[model samples]
Target: MNLQAVKILFLKDLFLSRRQLFAYFAAGLASSALTTIPNPTVSFVGFLLMITVAIASGIHLIGTLMLSESTDQTRLFVMSMPISLLDYSVGKIAVILTTYLIPWSAMFASSAILTFVLPTSKHGSFAVLPAIFLFLLCAFLIQLVTAVVSESVGWTISVMVGCNVGLNVFFMQLFASPEISAAAKSDSVSWPPVLIQLLTVELLIAAGALVTAFIAQTRKRDLV
Candidate 1:
């Protein structure tokens, strides 16, 4: 891959994505604010908010990137440049990851602030970090899949939002079950299994996205 070309593509996408980035940040800040309220269930609420922020931000970023290419007709210009499709795709992914890192850091910082201001235990805050990271990784993978498969902004947004919402609902029900709740409430709960499950799901989503993107790129006569 051409490093210089990748850098150029990255910068171009970064500039193009500024407005969407701002929207993502705004949404994250709003969610964090809503969830930071002092309450007995603050930990659970905050964790959910962090997941929501990550998923929303990922969806917006990926949807906007994919849609903008067509809407702004940047696909043609970008494709005409001296860069491989793989390089361009890599650059886009790099830009997306970097953009996401900002909101992820914000979520972490917000959690830290809440932990300090509230009566949450240090162990609780520590536990949240890994969960947030796993949720963000899953969200990113979902967005990557939507980006590759969607042809329009609305469709992309729908897929991203639908996947996140559906997963959240399903997981919430599973975790909130009487038996699971009892186990989770206990201090001796084993998180490794949950973490492994999340990792496996994230990997599967990422693998599907890679396959879809590869097939789409291969079939297209033009690259962007």
Candidate 2:
């Protein structure tokens, strides 16, 4: 594999992703700040904004760093370089995953902090927010794997939309669950049995999907 060429590709993708990442980070921070206020309507708006930040970041990064390269004129130039398919595969995985994780991690940390700091009544169940964030991560991984394996914008977009809908339904169900609503009165974070199982499932799915994507990449004859 051409390490230098891979490094260049990684850097190029990172540079291309900077602006969208900044906007996502800013919106996530804003959402966290919104939790500081006690208004229900404003907090609801904030929750929506947080979801938007998470989903939008994934969509943009997938397009700009992963899918766009395949359609761009750069594809031919990249293929003609010293880079092998392995190098291209490595660069795509590293660049797309790293670029996504930065803003995602920020959003995760901010949500965790907000969940902890905010009153139980204001945020509902403590573990719920973290679970939601994990779900988003899982959803993004599903999108990532879909894009990596299918290399089709249509499939990726379809999965994204489906995941988006699933997320909304999941969010409502989590909040509405008796375990979550009951724990909203507690001062401590509640890890109800069902919630714990859900979190574990999401974690497993995220890890499994990523590993699958890497395997598919390794077996590929072409990355361009």
Maximum-TM-score candidate: 2
User: Candidate 2, 84: how far from true, in Å?
Assistant: 2.9
Record all residue pairs in model 1 with backbone atoms less than 3 Å apart, i.e. clashing: none
- Compared with the true structure, the alpha-carbon lDDT of candidate 2 equals 0.79
- Model 2 misplaced regions, further than 4 Å: 1-5, 119-124
Q: Write the per-residue lDDT of candidate 2 for residues 60-133, one digit (tens) a residue.
A: 88887778877886767877977777777678778877877777787777777776666545444556766888
What TM-scores do the predictions have? Answer: 0.72, 0.89
| Cα error, candidate 2, residue 147 (Å) | 1.2
lDDT per residue as tens, model 1, 1-224: 78999898888878988887877677667767766565647646766776777876776677567667777797778878787777777787778877887887777777657555654333333433445465556567656655754555766666666776766675776565555445444444345465546557766766776677656655665564
lDDT of each: 0.67, 0.79
- Deviation from native of the Cα of residue 86 in model 1, angstroms: 1.9
